[model samples]
Target: MLLKEPRLNFTDVMNRKAQEKGIQLDNDQQRLIRHLETLAETLLRRRAAFAGLYLWGQPGRGKSFIVDSFFAALPLAQKKRAHFHTFFRELHQQLNGQGLDAALLELMGEARLLCFDEFHLHDIGDAMLVKRLIALAIARNVALIFTSNYPPRALLANPLYHDRFVPSIALIERHMTVMALNGPRDYRQQATGHGVFSEGAYLWPASAARRQALGLPDASGAVALTVGHRTLHAASSPGEFLHFTFAGLCEAPTAVMDYLALCEGHERWFLDGVPPLARVSPAAQQRFINLVDVLYDQQRRLFIAAACPLTELVAGVEQEDIARTASRLSQLTTE
Candidate 1:
């Protein structure tokens, strides 16, 4: 006896998930779903021959949501999805004792389709690695899908050194179809009063009520969370919320994996003493930006008590990326 192949009904799966999540797909979202359905069918018929998709838009525009829906609907066994930071962290670890090509092949394993969320380039070192990785993945005929806040030209948009990534950009353009999810609605802001953290999510200037809601008792003791070989200490850990000073989480030598572990461990997170961008070191600012990216990608709720409004948080070289963090912060509900 032979088994039957699963039905390739992307629309039905997407509609079901949307209904369960109480999401009303907007016109732009529906159009993207249609495109995803078409891509899914094409890939199903010709997995190796099909080119993939590159989706770009501003933060909170539902790029991740749409891609996630499509990825979840795919019935193939050879698909893998991961946040870009996590993927690269693991990639670097794999590269320590092996060549780049060998490490990429190992990382991909038997996966034919790879979905990367929050794809962007900032570090020169990472750019070099990604160029190699892209070439290798395309050579292996891996169908690639990515969600990013930047289109191809805007990636690493510094005028001083953007040309270094031209080869990678060209490869991407040749192998993938780029589309923008330029929707009118900012779904993150529209998510007010929806989740457990919605009640007292965003708190600025550290008011007494905010302190109380964050469970910051005067006699609270220090708490620590261990991730891999490193331990992250918090100022206080009371009830479901873990509280930290801005310096403790971002200014410290914390990595993306540490932020991911923190999100996994705590239901609610509170960060106090968030100084203005002018006051933070460039390194600390970058860490803060990465922290925000992790939290947003994981859909983890955070309560921030900052010195100034979100708009005035970063004023230095990282102003562009920090602006995205501030946008996400503003969308969260405040007490």
Candidate 2:
């Protein structure tokens, strides 16, 4: 027997849940809800008015909450929702294993709808790959809905590689119902929610006394561990924690793929010696941002020791996604 999803408007379902959690949908969020409701109707009625939906905005805008609610209420039997980076990580492996068309077909299976959160493109290589992903989904008429911090115009935004993604941008514009929930409230920064991610801790000016009192593994005991082809030193505590220095983890040429691979093996992660973003090089800042995104997506517990408070550290950074990093970091409760 196919289970029936309640026929509530996406707004009612989202608002009721949000209220219980002390999150009220602002005007912009509600506007997006109305749009989502329309999309849901289109899907429910078997109408192909749009191939997908894209919601883009700054961090903490409750994009995840809203989209999850909509997805949960969806009656479709074949649907999948994933964090963008996490999905791409798997997609890359699959593409390497089974060529382009075969990989997508295997991934898509019988899914009628796919929802991706934290959709973004910081590298041109990923952008080119995603371009194919989007194009294939369109050709097969697989619906894709995305929640991103970057607008379509801003994706693959490196000036040197921007032109390469125009076709993907055109595909998105023509096929998807792109909505902006650039709301005033960044619900993530509020620090009131509870989750595996929320139970994590943050320490400012992580003094020696602080690390000791928190029972964190000493960085002095860091042993060299191989990640992919590179050897990085991190303190391993039993099977629970893997600790690294910011310089060793982010300052080096560690890739997001490394973080994804490492995170699967370790449940708890700690990073020490994080200087304020204003003091760090742009490349290092981006690495840190990518690290946080991976951790947040994996819902792994993270402990961060920084030279200064997160507020001061994130201030003066020009990275567009830094706000997202800060917003996610904001969810960390003080230890």
Candidate 3:
């Protein structure tokens, strides 16, 4: 009898496992995956195409999982995958020793196939830097994959603030094939129902509960929560949970910096109410979305909110800001 041979198509196996894992390997995703597999196979055969894939979706849509799994299946020497925060933090830290340009150039040079998870920007300060890094990545012909809640058109929204990086946005659009994955139900909803999430993960503590939990001293005055030695004054109200006057935080209205400072030592916060704004402009709303994005990327805290559930709080926000906030809030659930 002739011996039977076992044939395996790794791409097919990956697609099957991806579907089984509840990832939304939809038509677009499947197409992209097939294209990617083709590119990889081509590279193995002839090393011709320098392929890049940008995967985007709202939170809970499995952007991270699919890209990560895909990269993992690739040969170790051929891939470099990084969380967006990790890349920035490492780049920033390296600046002390190698200088900014050097560090960025080094990172771009190191990765032949790069995957950036939770890619976003709020502060225009970082926007220009991102623009430069992306340019370097493309120049090197690196096969890049980025996972973001926002699609490519929204990648660098409010470019007026990032005027210097307009060219960079143009470059990213030029290089990447942007794809969006939308779903019928939130995957996080299933997790929440199963008790896979811990209540304290994103709980926004009422002022009273926080004070009691931390054993803070009361003097009939506003309570102070310290982050990296910076003090945020919050008031204690009965049954209101830990309370903060939004106006106070936005008094000077330095949106990004203040929240960065406020969230310095913690990953999550429990906000008591919607920000105090008589009429919120699109810019201001974007800032709020940025704040949530940063907090969620850190993945250290979960918010327990009172004014609204996560979805509604960001729903009425303008079109530009909607994707950013909804993408983040979509991952959250009420405890």
lDDT by residue for model 2 (134-217), tens: 887877767789999888999978889999888889989888887887767767666476478777789886778987876788
Residue runs of model 3 more than 4 Å from their true location after superposition: 1-10, 16-19, 22-24, 39-49, 57-60, 77-79, 83-86, 96-99, 121-125, 159-166, 182-268, 274-284
In angstroms, the error of model 2 at 286 is 1.0
lDDT of 3 by residue, 1-335 (tens): 97553222446766777667655466756766666676566444435445666777776665665576667666546567776756776677677777667988777665678888878765676787787777766666667788887766566577577566567667767777777776654565554322221333232433567536644323344676664446666645322233454433434243444555555544435444454232456555655655565565554344443354454555555545466455455555433
Candidate 2, residue 242: how far the Cα is off, in Å: 1.1
- When 1 and 3 are scored with TM-score, the better candidate is 1
The alpha-carbon RMSD values of the candidates against the true structure, listed in the order shown, are: 3.4, 2.4, 6.2
Candidate with the greatest lDDT versus the true structure: 2
Alpha-carbon shift of residue 313 in model 2 (angstroms): 1.0
lDDT of 1 by residue, 4-121 (tens): 7455677777788778767788777787788888777766765567467889988878888778877877877889998888888888889888898898889889887889998888
Instruction: Pull out the clashing pairs in model 2.
Output: 60-186, 60-187
lDDT of 2: 0.82
The all-Cα superposition gives candidate 1 an RMSD in Å to the true structure of: 3.4
**TM-score of candidate 1 on Cα atoms, chains taken together:** 0.84
| Highest TM-score against the true fold, candidate | 2
